[model samples]
Target: MRHRRIGRSGLLVSEISYGNRFAHRESANCARAALEAGITTFHTAAAWGHGAAEEALAEGLREARRDDIVLCTGVFWLEHPGASQFGLGRKHLMSSLHGSLRRLGTDHVDVFQLWRFDHRTPLEETFLALSDVVREGKVRYVGTAEWTAEQLLRADALANELRVPLLCNHAHYSMLWRAPESQVMPAAARAGIGHFASMPLAQGILTGKYRQQRIPPGSRADNDERGRSAVRPFLDASLLERVDLLRGIAEEAGLTMAQLAIAWALHHEGVASAVVGASRPAQVAENARASGVELGIDVLTQIDQLLGGFVQSDPRLTFTPTQYDDL
Candidate 1:
């Protein structure tokens, strides 16, 4: 697997990091497979399965060398204390990190991210809490996910003010969703922050498996709440037609729809890593192979035509909850 540094830091990660949100049941095997596949980076979120995801990942890493796997997780919610497994407040961030470390059976994590942009709290307050964690050695790096370009810039400014290093932003950017091309990607590039594209598969929509009309049994689309909600807005004829066209392009490229979809995400220069979640080991290997496939200019141009080329942010054009506020 190809590896790259996160942001401008010396910390290196695989091009395709293993996403642990849905790998809970078989996390041990998943981690073993990832190591066999040369994927050393693994990421999870506190809100995913309400901490079961991280716990599973911890269990998986037990069999692997501690230095071989880089672990990360985010505080999922910043609302009421009950809303999140760990709120973003100083107290909550510390308490949550300790609990996460204990669960993972580690003293420190490679990266700890804020799962969402908390509009309710001052950005400084949150950044400060993260800075404290870094100083105390509980978290090696700090990052954010699903935040706007403006919010990311402000975060960097705050990090600078506090002398804390802000590493990256985790967002969803795929052929079906390219909102980051306009603001998020450019902002991260300018601020010297890495951009990790989460959910490059669009909850299996880009895999062409769903074109069969029904979600396959045991697939993320069939089992996860977010997966189900994400596909709801795209039930219209226009979007479905677009999806079909994109699938045709993938066929011409001699690639599975999954390969084309993942390659489409890696094609973006701003993306430092693409975290791929798989339910099975074979699925993980398939995604890892796409790291060798790169789309040339001609294929990318054809793809642009199918994807409407430009970033479209009409709230009316959302495909899922993750795509809802994309702009």
Candidate 2:
């Protein structure tokens, strides 16, 4: 697998990393397969499978050296009782990290990210808490997930003021979802922060399984109701046409649709790593194969035209405003 430096850090990670949601036993096998395929990075979230996924990954790491795999996890959806589970309140973040440590079977994570930007918590409080983790050696670096460019800039400036390392930001980016270019990618590049792209396949929409008038059996659309709902607004007739055009490009390149999608993300200069979530070992292998193939500028331009002018019009795009009353 090809390796790239994560932000300005000397640490180099594989272009494609493994991600797990809940498949404990299955994820263990997947990790092994990923290691065999030369994928050295693994990402999981505390909220993933409600923490069961981290437990399984920790169990899998028992067979490998700690340094052999670069482990990362985020704190989101932890039980916060009175406070919102999504933010970075001190009580909530401390409780959540302890729980994540217990589940991951590690005291420190390579990169500890907040699952989302906590608009509620005072930036100072959140930054201090993150700095404390690094100071105490419980986390090597800090990051945020699903945050906008403004939030990232504010956090980086805070990190600079506090003399702490703010390493990266994690968000979803793929051929189908190119929204990061407008702000997130540029902000990260300017601030020397890594941008790890999640869901490189657009929740399997770009996998070339769905066709005109036929949704493939066992696809995310068939099996994941929430995923289908999330894509409904974007899946209008025009987008379907775009998907078909994208399919032709993939076919011409002699690669699978998933491979082309992942390659698109990895081809970017600003992307530190593309996190791939797989249900099976074969899926992990297929994703790892993408690191080797690079899409040329001509291919990217064609894809841009085919998929341009699309917006995330799904209802889920506008989430309930974050709770800041407690702060």
Candidate 3:
């Protein structure tokens, strides 16, 4: 697998990072397969499967050298009883990091990210807390996910003030969703912040597995309520027809539809890594092969033409408002 440095930081991550957003049950096996396939970066969030995903990954990485893997996790959301229990407060951030470390059986995560933009808290307070974690040697680098262009700029400025590097931004980017390309990508490029393409497959819609209206048995659409909701928005017949056209291109290129979709995401200059989640070991192997597959300009143009009008590039699609205004 190809590795790229995140932003201007000294750390380098695999171009195709393994994630455990929906692969809770088989996370261990999937992670192992990814490692075997040369995927050095693994991403998980504290809220993913209520922290079970991290535990599974820890178990999976038991046989590998700790220094060989780049582990990433996030804070700002927890499975607590009350609403105030979450956010970017110092208490919550520290507690979340400690909990994640214990579960992952690691002293420090390679990267710790803010799962969401906590508008309820001051940016200074949040950055200060993140800076403290880095100083304490609990986190190597800090990052954010689902943050808008403006939010990223503000955070980067604060990181400069605090002498902390806000190294990466994880945002939804895929063949179907190009929202980040317009604003976040340019902003991050100018700020020297690498972009991690989360949900690079549009929750498997771009994988060509769900061709018709019916949800496949034992698939994420059938098992995960949130996954179903996320995939529901792109379930139009016209979209499916376009997917069929893309499949032909994949075949001609000697690639699976999923690999073509992943290669498409990695084609962008600003994207450092494409974070992909898989439920099976074979799927991990398939995604690993797309790491260095650079599409020719002709094929890239054809993909854009086929996906015309189907690309969802609206910035508002990734906007997340503050949950608590009073805080």
Candidate 4:
């Protein structure tokens, strides 16, 4: 696997990073496969299966040396009763980090990210708290997930002032979702913050499995309510039709639809890593192979011609507004 540095940071992550958002039953096995395939970066969150994902990762990497793995987790979305239990507040962040560390069986995660921007809280307060974690040696680098370009710029400035420089920004970027290219990608490039592309497969849409309105058995949409809701928007006939066209191009290039999608996401210079979710070990192996696969310019143009109009470039799609109000 090819390794890329996150901006100017010392951290070098695998081009294809393993993420455990769904937290499948074979999570440990899949993670092991990722490691065997040279994927050292593993991403999880406090809200992912309510810490079960971290536990599985800990078990999967139990035999590997701690320094060899780049474990990443997020705060701002823990299971708690009160409103104060979420967001980037000092109390909540401290508590959330402690819980994550305990679950992962590690003294420090390579990167600790805020799951979402806490609009209700001042940026100063958030950065101060994150800087404290870095100083205390609890987290090596600070980052954000689903934060907009503007929000990332503000946070990066604050983090610099606090001496903790925000090193990464996790956002949705896939063959079907090109939203980050418009603003987030440029902003991260200018700020020297590495962009980690989440949902590189568009939640399995680019995998060519959900075609002709047929949701395959045991698929994410069939098994998880939230997964179904998340992918429902892209189920229109027009989008699927475009995917069919892209599939033809993938076959012409001697690649699977999923491989084509992953290679496309990594083609951008601004994207340092593509965070992919997998339920099985085989899926992990397949995705890892796409890391260094460079598509020809003609093939890229064909992909864009087929999918340009279908791309979801809305900046607001980065994070849900209701999440803040619900908290």
lDDT of 4 by residue, 1-327 (tens): 999999778889999999987566899998899999999999999777777888998888888889998999998775545444778888888888999999999899999988888877888988888888899999999888888889889888887789995789888889888877888888988889997889999989999898997888888898978879988988988889889888788888888888899889999998889999888899999999888889999999998788878877887677634455644
**Pairs in clash, predicted candidate 3:** none
For residues 157-261, write the lDDT of model 3, one tens digit per residue.
999989886899998898888988888888988898998888888888888888876678777888878779878988899998898899999999999999999
What would the per-residue lDDT of candidate 1 be over residues 114-161, giving only the tens digit for each residue? 877765567777888888888988888888887777788999899889
Cα error, residue 258 of model 3, in Å, equals 0.4
Off by over 4 Å in 2: 79-86, 213-215, 311-327
Q: How much is the lDDT of residue 44 in candidate 1?
A: 82
- Estimate TM-scores for all models: 0.89, 0.90, 0.96, 0.96
Task: Assess candidate 2 and give its TM-score to the true structure.
Answer: 0.90
Model 2 agreement with the true structure over 1-327: per-residue lDDT tens digits? 988988877778899998877654578888888888898888988776677888888876677888877889887565434445566878778878888888888878888887777666798998888888888988888877877778889988999998777878787887767667777777888999887888888877788565563566755566677767765655567777787788789989988888899999888788888999776889889888888797888998998888877734232332223764533
RMSD of each: 3.7, 3.2, 1.8, 1.5
| Number of the candidate with higher lDDT, 2 or 3 | 3
Name model 3 segments beyond 4 Å from true: 81-84, 324-327
